[model samples]
Structure formats: C-alpha cells, structure tokens
Target: MLKEKVYAADGDVHPDQQRIYGRGTELMDAEELVSLHVHDGKCILDLYLRKSKEISVLVIGMHGTRHKVAVDIFSTIKQLKKHLYWENNFCLEGKVLMFNGIHLDDSATFSNYNIDDKSVLYALEIPENHMNIKIRISTRDITSVFLSKSETIKNLKLMIRQHTFIPVDQQELTLHDTVLEDNKTLFEYFQDQEDGQILTLSLIHHIRISLTVCINMFKSSDYVVQSVSLLGSDTIEMLTQIVYQRVFILPKQQQLKKNGQILEHSKTLSKSNLTNGDIIFVDILPLCKITINLGEGHKPITVEILPNDTISEVKDHIQKESGILMNNRCLLHEGAVLEDHKSVDDYDIKDGSILFLSQRPPELVTLTFQRTSGEVSELKFNPRDPVSVQSTIQNIIKGENESASKSHVYECKQF
Candidate 1:
C-alpha cells in the first residue's frame, strides 16, 4: 500500500520511510487530512487507526493560520510531540492541541481518547462550535450562555444552571414544541438553522404556572369584585368556586355559573380559553326596588323585587303590609294599569319608580220605591253598604215627604 505523508515543519520527506521505484513502479501524490466527517459511531480512534505510519493533517488554529503537522501513528502522542510544529516554527510544548475537537493530552493515546463519539468534530471547527446562546426565562429576563454546539444537551443544562442558579433537573429546554433530549448535541438540534440568529429557547420550570384572574360579579351583581391567583392547569369550575366563595353568598347546594351556562369541571383554564389576567364574569339574576303609593297619602312603601316577578306578586306583597286584599287592589304606573299576569319589567317600573295602589270602587245598584199614592222615589245602593236595603229605601222615601201625613212610598224595580 502507498501511504500518504508530509513533513513535520516543512514538506521534507522522512529519510528512512522514503522509497526509490524502478521500472513499472507506481508513485502517487500524498493526501492531506484537512477535514473530518463526524457520525454517531465514528471516533478519533477509528480515524487514527485507519491510517498507518505517517499522516499529514492540515489544522486551522484560532488565529486563522494553516498548520501542517506530521503525526507518526507508530509512536506515542508524547513521542510525536517533538516533531510537531505550527506556522511560526513555534515548538509544540505547552501548546494545547486538539484533534477532531478533543483536547489532546500527553497521557491520552489514539486508543484511549476520552470523548463522546457523537461530539467529535473537525479540528478547524472548534471555534465555530462555541456558540453564544441566549436563554429566556421570561419576557423580561434573558441570560446569555456560552457553550459548544458539540456539547450534549445535558452539558448545556449544567452550564446554564451555573449561570442561572437553577437546578439542572428542574430545567426544561424547548425549541418550539420539540423538547431537547439530553443525549443529543446542540448542533444536531439546530443544525438546519442559520448562525448568529437569536434562537428562542423556552425555559420551563417544574413548578406550577402562576397567573392572575379578575372576577367580575357585576354581570350578576355590581357589588362583588375580586382578584385571584390560579395555576394554568386549574379548571374553570375550580376558579368559579374560589371566586363565588368570597363574593356572593350561595346556598349549600348552589353552584356558580359562567355567562348563564355551567362551566365544565373537567376542562382546564387554559383549555377553556381562560388565559392569564383574564376576567371571569359571574352570572346572576337582576334585581330592582319598587315603591308602591298606597293612596293613604302617607309615606309610600318600597319593596325589593325581581324584574321577572309577576305583577300579582307585587300586589300580594302590598296587600300583606297594608291589610288590603290583592283582588281588591289595582296598581297603576304612569296612568297605565298593570296587568297581574305581566312581569314587573314589562311595565318598565324601573328602580326607584312609584306605582299607585288604590282600593277598587264597589259596584253601585239603583233602587226605586213607589208609594200607593202613585209617588216614586229613587235611591243609590252600594252592594257592600252596611245598612239593609229596605231601611235605606224607607229612609229615602221618608225624606222625600215633608210630613208624615203626606209620606211618599217608593218601590225598587229592575231597570
């Protein structure tokens, strides 16, 4: 096999390793190892063992200088260091050397390199892999973290923990919906994206998400107002209970409603479309106060009533307080008689408005009395009159006659 080789400092060939070929002998140009392809199972040991004797590798240093060094695979790394040199003919002593992204050590050999096979990168790509990543803890907080793209996700988390003072186990790094795995390298996760672009990484903690919720009972009643803190995972029904527990006094079996509909207990707040800093309005029945003028001309009686109450209910309440029967009472507002079957809201009896209440006039019957002398007497009669009708008619007939001798008689007749 024709092995490729280059000089340590210059392109001079090693004396003992050279060969002179005669007729029909093949001579090939030397191949320089400039780049390396990293894979899941490939390692620096595999690359070194694939070549034998002498190998020339082109290394690009941090200062942008090309370095050609000859490595003798047959000798140890400590022994080959004497012949290695860089651009200014600088000796390789105390200089940090890296092959395939691994920092070289005198004690480490090709067979004993300590590194993850997936993290092994080309020598010149070391600088490009050092990325200045930004970690966003919140909208107001952003922390910068310097890490290598060849580093594993677990390693990155460790470095971030040092800068953020957060526990590594509690941290979760995510790009979009994709959660980064600890075994994967940063380069693999963001390989398709461009460099220098701000990569947005979501930093989620293990604790529950906190948010503020505004409870508005004005939809039900204007008196209740409350603010509460809730977890994002909490359900809408849970929030309803917490809010109503403080605002409105509910019965033992009563439950709060939302927008006139019962909230689903199993749906989370986020799932129910209730986001942070959201307002939850409590559904309540509207109430109004009505004042009734009882014709006694004294102070009018005011009573609390619902808009949905029937007109009969209002009259009943008025009757109970004023000793007037509901049927005997008629209520009128603004010259309009209120029907018993209609609701209070239908009559537009707004809050603080006055309604007139008066006893119905009794039906009157006319009485006519005729005397034997052909004289006639007429008198008006009330069905609920306290005196007897006969007495009332006799009295009226007596008044029509000036004297007892000329008394007139009246008889009642149907008209």
Candidate 2:
C-alpha cells in the first residue's frame, strides 16, 4: 500500500478530499474534514492523511512587480494574503486577488483552482470604500449608491438589490459592448470613468446595465445622436414621451427606427432591436401647422404644436422663438382669449387655425374728453378695444361714487 503524510490548512481537510477516487466511497464536502472511505462496510483508502505537493506561485503586484513564493497547494488564499502582507509590508485590506482572471476566494484553497508551479496571481490594490455608483431607470428616475472599492461586481448587484426590486441574479451590467463579469471590481470597470460626484442624492439609482439605449434625433435635416439613457422594458410609446420632453415633439409626431426599420409605438425598446447604447433613429412625424400672427401687422409665423400641449406650453415655445416673455404674452383665437392653463384640444384648436399673439392689457392708450364748458380732460386705460374705452371709463367714474349720466356731457377722442 502507498500511503502519504498530510498537512492540512483546514485542520486536515482540502478540496482534494472530496474527490471520488474510489467507487466504494461517496463524495464529501471539502470543509467536512472527514473522508469515510468505507464501502460495503469495508475501508478502501485513507486519503485525508495525504499531503499535497508544494507549488511555486508568481504574484503580480499592483505596481507590476513579480514575486515568486512557494506555498502548499492546499493552503487557503486567505493564508497566502496574510503571508504576502507580513513578508512585504503590503496593504492588508482593499486588495483583489485573482488567479488566471478568476477572483480568488479567501476561504478557497489554491489546489481547488488547479494552481501549479507556473501559475500567476494578480493582487490589485483599490480604494477601500466610498465609491459611489448611480443607477438610473428609463423614466429618468435615479438612485445613488456608495460602495466599497474592495467589493466585487457580485457585491454591486447585491447593492442594487437594496435600492430596486430587481434580483441580483437577474441584473446584468455592461460597458462598451462587453458584459461585466460577477467577479470583477468597479475599479476594473470604471477606472477611466469621469462621472463626477453629485450631492449624494440621485433621483433613484438604477446601475449601468447593458440594457441602456441611445437616441438619434433628427436635427437640421440630419440625425444627431443624443446620449439619452433608456431601459429595455421601456416601450416605444414611452420612449416617445421621454423624447418629447427634450425635443417638444408629440409622440404622434415622432417615429423611431432601429436598423433602418420603423419601430412600432406599442413595442418595447428591446423588442425593437435596440441594445445597450444602440442608436435609435428618430424622425419627426407629420404635424398640423398653425398660423401664429406675431402682432397686428407682423408676418404670420408657422408653428407646429401638439394637441395635448397647454396654452402655457405654447407660450413657452413662442418665448423661445420670438424672445418674448411668456407672462407678458397672450394668445387670441377668434377674438377670444386663450387661457394659459387650457390645452389646444380644450380650445378645439386644429390645423390652419389662426392664433393671434398679442399683449395682455397692452400699454396705455391716451384719450381726451372735451367738456361742453370748453374744458378738456385726459383718460388713460389699458383696453381690449378702443370702442369699449368710453364704457370702461364711465364704469370707473361710477365706481368712484359719481354718476356718468349726471356728469357734464363730453365727446371722447383718441390721442
């Protein structure tokens, strides 16, 4: 019989102890520290007392230096980290240990990963904590989170789970067309990112996932890509509403295209063949043109407004185009005033409707009244009509405790 001497890091257990080398033995957990080799009520082998061979490992430190160290193959990575820290006076925390791109678990043994004399391990140093990541939803709601640099991508998903209802396993993060692995660190992913910090408050945080989409809008008769963040579950109709907030185009007046195919409004962004950071082309749908006469004698301005837009919103657009303060402007349709809070649909405003852009209670107009006794008096009022100015003045006199009928006769004339 060939028997071997064993020295174990687990007090006498190793990953190799779980190997089913004999048909008579059942597999056991590495942490069980017991290898009952009895089969058919008879013992076959005592492998738990076996010792693994020593292996030389080359460690690539953060500064790019290489150090070869010999250690037992059954030693846990935690023990190796402790030895590295004591020998080189290295950092004891915020370090990510990796072997062949695999994140090494502190509780896992080197032999479990099949490490040999020629194996190389990377020890990367990172910030200890206070790394903030902001996750955003398609609705533009954001959630802000601060995580430890020592944390793994798996930890990141767990952090995301705390803020959103999405499960950790269901969450997928991506960057620049590559899916981020669970074992990777944020420092590895966002090392070059320049996302500056805000006031530690995000509207709601939804982390960067491969599910974001970009918008390409038509501007100046050509397409310009806008870095608009969107979620996969957002429907094309919802996308239109999101786009409308920026472009002022109604959903009905907007058509989206992906891969040169027109995207349906009822379909989700993902169903439209849109992927993370994919450019969704937008074209303004045909809209009804309304004639807005800037002033009494000014040339008519052609404007397209959505039916759902309020008069206040229309005033905002006019302010942008004509450089007029919305509060100082008012719209007149068919000789009736358009209230700011009302919508175009409320007014039944349609295509080719003539809207008069005018000022409210315009600058004072002067009027002179000639009394029968050869006396002249001046009356000033902001009027809707010159013809109503006389009646308005008469009402003002009545309010002042004077009867306009009993007052001396006078003929009014505009100055």
In model 2, which range of ten residues has the least summed lDDT? 28-37
Q: Each candidate's lDDT (Cα)? A: 0.55, 0.62
Per-candidate RMSD, Å: 29.5, 16.5
RMSD of 2: 16.5
Name the candidate that leads on lDDT.
2
Question: Which lDDT tens digits does candidate 2 get at residues 1-415?
Answer: 0111232334455434434344455432211112232335564544544467899998888888777778998888888888877886665376666665445556556765667887998877533433546554322222344555556888777755644456565566654436667898876766654332211222222222232234445455455445565655557797778778866767777767767888889986556766554566777644557888897656777777877678998888777777767677789998889999998989988989989888775677787776545666677776776667777667545544343355655578776
Clashing pairs in 2: 135-205, 135-206, 135-207, 136-206, 142-204, 142-205, 143-204, 143-205, 253-285
TM-score of 1: 0.26
Q: What TM-score goes with each of the models?
A: 0.26, 0.37
Candidate 1 per-residue C-alpha lDDT over 172-202 given as tens digits, one digit per residue, 9 for 90 to 100: 7888868798899989987765543346677
Which candidate ranks first by TM-score, i.e. highest? 2
Which pairs clash in the backbone of model 1?
Answer: 368-411, 369-410, 369-411, 370-410, 370-411, 371-409
Candidate 2 Cα outliers beyond 4 Å, as residue runs: 1-55, 59-76, 82-252, 255-286, 316-327, 361-415
